[model samples]
Target: MERPQNMSIAPRIAVGVIILFHAVGLVGLSLPATRPLFLQVVPWHLLLMLLTIVFGHYKLSGRFKAFILVVFWLGFFAEWIGVHKGWLFGNYAYGTTLGVKMFDIPLMIGVNWFLLVYSAGVTMQRSGLKNGFVRVVTGAGLLVLLDVLIEPVAIKFNYWQWIAGSIPLKNYACWFLVGAVMLYVFELFNFKKQGIAAPALLITEFVFFGALNLVIGLWPL
Candidate 1:
């Protein structure tokens, strides 16, 4: 079934704003003088990204809406457990960089998860993979790949800290497990394609984190 022609000026504006915001962030974080200030506003950047996705995909069906809620709470609960019990994603603790926290879990963490999973799911759907299992695996793999780029930069920005100065293998394992389940739910809903927003958001985040990782890895300043 064809997706409804619900496209409008709003998503375009949102994408433009996101591009401009990231452009500034890339330039600002590259400079030592502005890096600290940029990092302090990371939470707001995250919020804007979330809003951009919401605005872009505003015409969601009922099932898609329910999927979003379920994925969000799943992500939130996983992080909550991971922080307090060190069970899900290994021994990791949130830092002040991601802004406010509830029970030591950053609220933006759940938002970030939903954003990535949704984007990745939509991206896989566009891949023309007819097999649901293949789509699920590939989508989850994409999420893990993004996490690879994010982890180092996240630690450098003090978004979270890992024990023993290294990310544990368990973290990635749990990410795949949770990501696969989330993608499965996404596939179950069989949502109509929204537009380029999902792919754009995914690629933007990938580039943003990947560039930051490369810069920080090389300079280590």
Candidate 2:
């Protein structure tokens, strides 16, 4: 039996920061004056999220390190191909709001991908689901739904622009495909199902984007 005295406080701390930052971000981005400043912090927000999830894991073994590298580079390259070749998520271009660019894609975009996919993986992993395929599909579905909410907010904030100002069905479909592939990578790894931080982050992501959609829809800012 584990003792409460031995419990790590890192997950709790991470969760608190996740909630605090996202709440601040949502409010800051909703207003006219603070929007740009908040948007500038978006990459740092992503990095913070990545760090929290990394901290939640606590024990970084070789395979786990491999998982991080694979996801980061794979996500970066996928976006590279998607942006330059217009293959993966359709014809959308990133904006300057996300920060510095490599091949016109923000370096932090990979961090964004890792954050989304990892949280989805952890959420589904703890969902009491028994099959790998089901977890992958469900997690991917969750991300697609979040993307539906995110598209408008992303566009309004200039995170990325869809070609001709129209988002395609192709984008959502590819989000599912790519998300599932990443979740599949997650499943192949064996990590302890001990942290609420990932699930909290995932739920907070939905809340952040969903709340922004509602706020933006009402106010048009």
Candidate 3:
């Protein structure tokens, strides 16, 4: 999706909320005093972000809606395989922080996947890159970069834990491959210029995790 030209108030509001939430989240997560409360609301925060992205734009096209369903299941199933068989992502088990699990995997994993892939798609789509495959590859690479920032913090915060007690190289490799597959599917669709919410969310995620990683660096490993 592309950023809508002449964006209305909703997109601006969405952007504001994105910045506000991440800033608050940064403060909340970094400080020991507020960490537990913020951690408990992680799932709700995700839902709110989804709402902000969805409602910030007009009604979705049928194709885009279909795309959403496909990506959600793709993400969940991929995670299922990873969690159960140690195939896709790695041998990592989720903790309670992300909330309710299905088949021992958090349902929110799919939502997280959709949000990240959608945001990455929109961010790339808005770019000047004219090649579809290149965009997909670049977006996949972008996700891998974000994952680099997210992994250690995620492990520290109990989002998921590696079975081996250390992140493996295969984890990042699989992330790029799985992310590329999803992004390739994203490229198959022709979505309209929607709103700024997608890219804003993506950037906010990077900032949020990036800050967390920096803060976590201060702790003894």
Candidate 4:
């Protein structure tokens, strides 16, 4: 018997398994006591970078690749500066959200945000967005939209430990500004075109974490 070339069991099964795990995690998060804590430690942000690499969205034209690398490093440094100097995110300080510290900030947290913004740049490119006004605006908007989902979860889970209660609108505005400008730079370098494989990456993330969050009960365990 000849199998269809288009038919492959591996990806289907892999994606299914990822979805299942995430779902279970989500379910565990529903408990009132567990919900806050559960949301904090989970590595959902890293999933974005994982998506980029697994789907081969990391490769780009040499010049563009270099540009993205610069942006990545810059994002990391910016986060470190923000956390330590208290210029942007405020004086709440980090605990579970940051995990461990390096240079008075969470090393892993810096890495996560860097990769997250990079992934956003990659996804925007894949969305057929380009280096124009509309594309740039649209791409930035999507990043903000994703944040909309992340913020409540972060606060609920005590990720940033907002001291004054609730996330400030200014904080969100800064997110949009940073993301939009970074993406704009990527577009300028034409790295945005390297996003053809973004759909697969996004699907992988959605299946994995979406399911995980679902199973985890969208709260803590």
**lDDT of each residue in 1-221, candidate 1, tens digit only:** 23336643365676677778888998888789999999899889888887777767747557766877888888999999898998898998899998889888888888888888989988888888889999999889888888999999888888999977899989999999999998998888878766667777888888988898888978895
Query: RMSD of candidate 4 to the true fold?
Result: 5.9
Q: Per-residue lDDT of 15-83 in model 2, one digit per residue for the tens?
A: 899999999988898889888788889888888888777867746568777998889988899899889
C-alpha lDDT score of every prediction, in listed order? 0.84, 0.86, 0.87, 0.55
Candidate 1 vs candidate 2: which has greater lDDT? 2
Which 10 residues in a row give candidate 3 its minimum summed lDDT?
A: 1-10
Q: Write the per-residue lDDT of candidate 3 for residues 104-150, one digit (tens) a residue.
A: 98988888999999999888998879999999999999999999999
Per-residue C-alpha lDDT of model 4 across residues 1-221, encoded as one tens digit per residue: 23224322334443444455445555556556665565555655345344434334333346745764666566666666666775765555555654666665655664555455555666666665434666667666666666666655556555566667767776667677777777677667764244233344344444444444554454343
Ranked candidates (TM-score, high to low): 2, 3, 1, 4
- Model 1: residues >4 Å from true position, as ranges? 1-5, 8-11
Tell me which of candidates 3 and 4 scores higher on lDDT: 3
Q: Which of the two, 1 or 3, has more lDDT?
A: 3
TM-score of each: 0.92, 0.94, 0.93, 0.66
lDDT of 4 at 5: 41
In terms of TM-score, which candidate is stronger, 1 or 4? 1
Q: After superposition, how far is residue 116 of candidate 4 from its true place, in Å?
A: 2.9
Off by over 4 Å in 3: 1-9, 219-221
Model 3 accuracy (lDDT, Cα) = 0.87
RMSD to truth, every model: 2.3, 2.0, 2.4, 5.9
TM-score of model number 1: 0.92
User: Pick by TM-score: which candidate is best?
Assistant: 2
